[model samples]
Target: MTCTKIAYVVAGTISIFLGVLAFHVYEVYNQDDPDVFPHNLFFPLWFSMDWPSQRTYPFPDHIQYVDRQYYAEILRNPDYAQKLRDENAQYQILDRLFRLKIIRDKFGIPLTLTLDESDTFSMWVEPKYPTFHGIDVGIGKKDGRLYVLYNWHIHSVNLFEDINGMIADIGSQFDSMVCSDKPTVVDGDLVTIDLLLPSSLNDPNKVAEKCGDREYRMCVQGTYHLHNTSGSPVGVLGYTGVIDFTHLGINRGFRVKSLQLKTTENGKRVLYKLN
Candidate 1:
């Protein structure tokens, strides 16, 4: 996938990472015994919209028009609103996602939220997609029907060519997806692609190779297209690209030009370029 702002999703355990956040939730939940609280006080796995259940989180301070309808619906629903009560029911959501969808450097994106209780109350939202975990997928509105236009995972690649990226950004990085122009490519001559990566230094466990104790690593994925000319008839020989999963992906420049194919064996002349 092409590394864009769309890929940055908030995927993390809210308890520790977001601990400094609203302490009121903690104070209310732990008024009596800390042992009663779930070790992971987030990811409301028990209740789902599917089984007439509701998962609640903090209401955003701002008056966001984008998700006003969705919030209004939840606030109006008793099942949904009940979850916010202080231990009002047998099960409560430790954490929840009100409106968060982002995609980033293909790494460390919020992926899952699970419930711990045995309540029949199952909750749900909408058309969640695969390969969407690493993206910042959130709720929004479009023509009255609610939609999701969140950003997600970060990826990067550098190449000096003028072809539409096919393999790397094959599915997600099209013109309409990024609000950018589609690139054309010429299919002759050798092209070079370079890459750089970053680490979060959060891998204190030393289990992650790229993390290396970094708080985070910016992984990336991208492609560089190349094309041929009208007079040429030779296919491409071969090429290589640097693979780095640490930094977010980027395309410096994409240019389409006419090029002639080099003779391989039978003096065949092949060229590839934009139409």
Candidate 2:
């Protein structure tokens, strides 16, 4: 090749090498600055490169529920973290409630449910003392009727029939408390019953402190606003009493021990304390 031709080829090659090096330097310096995209002219602004500043949240494969703890840790801000925890607690409570079975009507009008505001759905779990596991209690509306659902963990076969049988046995006691002839539904882990509203809310004689051989005592009291299906305003019940959950055996999966619900106004309601 001629020397002139060789020189020209080398010049072109050097220009290309210099151009590539300058582009690499530009990318390294400006990639982190999201604002630099608008000024660039050589390359299309849309041409993308991964930046360290960007973050991603990928969903897990096996985890069915939200990873609340992971988010809390990453959030760092105390207010947001606390909010997340509260939401998680609310979610878990709702999950348990949704799984509960309607106790009274085996087959009847499917009652739609609505809970009090998220802030109102609170719980106080008493630590298990020896054989008597503590109870879980909360109040909500089933269609137009106000009801409370409460339960404790038990050792039992995870079969539907066995759970139902346990509900029938334990529920008999629950029924006596509220004077309810309604049947019970079994949720997972514990026998969660959709309590049947008692026919006789005024019958104080029906409260059962003993079921078969087991002896127990229970009391429930709270005040909450009631709402109808249309989400209209319903009057709030203002009355308070101690929730007395005495010693109860672990056998038969204590569904509802005993519930004593009262209101200032003359409202027809039976709040049974489940043992």
Candidate 3:
């Protein structure tokens, strides 16, 4: 072949290779924008083009649109509304479960409401139905209270050293089911409740070792009080649960496990009772 013909062939090959490379780059960046077409073969090329007209603009808050539709359907359903009301009535005893407050972190990001140390409520909200029982506190009232409009809610509490507090949170709802009106039975039979412990507590040499020898597990024991409608304590209830550290260590997160509750004398205790 002549030199001029060979040069033309080489130029054609380089152009095709460069085009393929550009398409790959565009695909990587546009993965989140599925609507962008031709995968926008030369991503940088679109920068020189007119905005919106030449490039497919990312869709407006599709999640918000879907959420609006979701709530609209809920609003239209009488049964769903009744269900929510029923849940509220069932957990009314826990209406004051936690003294919650909202504050902002250093970056001005509105931090979610967290539980304060002391509060009075003797029922537990099921983990699956937290939205039904969460206390909604709006800020910026005319009376000089601050408010924040948040899309999400806090679903879990950090126990820290408050073991009995955590027990009350998990046990009250179950107790309510057993005895809502009558003087609560402190010496009731053991009833199963949901409990989950952190994976960090799965230490065989430390936590698990104290639980059992053949089967390594971590056991938690705590006490909580039950009250009647007038806010007088009936008695102290005891809770004990075991965690399968073997499974927890492998999964590296929380999973629902069974815990049992019974009544105990104020001074006498079982399981991980604090001094």
Candidate 4:
């Protein structure tokens, strides 16, 4: 190629490179210094945390659920020069907003639901004895009190029937607390249940024939808020008390069980009766 043509080509390439760099510099200069929250982003990004360890919350996978953590991590990632290329680093860009409806319904209405401000949507419960915690997880209530069951229990099941059976077995065989008859809540009706413990269940000295005489006593109590809908609804009740949990999984320690619940007419409402 001729010297003149070569020089012209080099000049054009250098100009194009300079223009790209100038645009980048201009963007950095004009960028707003974010304070606390961004003035550009007035929309609140909210999410419920799920802590299997109750700390070092694993950020939600959704962009909105983890926008702050994502962007902040992106900014904090510095070019590392250790042995070779950095391993624990990620590069990210903030260039989009996600918008969609949050669905927390099971089946459909007469069991359809609209989230109320007062209504419990989710929870991050830490047990009374934080140190003795089993696990913590995010729970969205589909029908009503189901959220309580899901949050409190860590058995790794989500089906309503599965949850119900787990509660029944846990109450009866483990905790000595029994669940009242099948829930009688109706659609849109808010029902509060004052569940009671079995008389001898919480006794510290209570012994079982199967235990070979290792007796431990602990109290079990729980109050569940049950709501029923025309659609089949299954919910949960959470409680805590003291007991020897040495046999926590073998039905040895304090736990929950289901009791046959009888309902009798009271004024115009039916109330639970446990025999």
Candidate No. with top lDDT: 2
Pairwise TM-score winner, candidates 2 and 4: 2
What TM-score does structure 2 among the candidates reach?
Answer: 0.21
Tens digits of per-residue lDDT for model 3 on 1-275? 99999899879876875686555554444456333222222111111111112111111222122134434554565464233223322232122121111101111222111122332222111111111112222222223322233232222223221543344446545656763322232345332223223444333235323322211122233334444344544344343333332443322212212222222334543221111
Q: Each candidate: how many clashes?
A: 96, 11, 5, 17
After superposition of all CA atoms, the RMSD between model 1 and the true structure is 25.0
Global lDDT of model 1: 0.25
- Which ten-residue region of model 4 has the weakest summed lDDT? 89-98
Sort by lDDT, best first: 2, 3, 4, 1
Q: Tens digits of per-residue lDDT for model 4 on 37-130?
A: 2112111112222222222212121211223333354345333111001111000000000010111232222222122233221111222111
How far residue 193's Cα lies from its native spot in candidate 1, in Å, is 18
TM-score of each: 0.16, 0.21, 0.17, 0.19
Give the Cα-based TM-score of candidate 4 against the true structure. 0.19
Deviation in angstroms for 5 in model 3? Answer: 32
After best superposition, candidate 2 residue 25: deviation in angstroms?
52
State the C-alpha lDDT per candidate: 0.25, 0.31, 0.31, 0.29
The most accurate candidate by TM-score is: 2
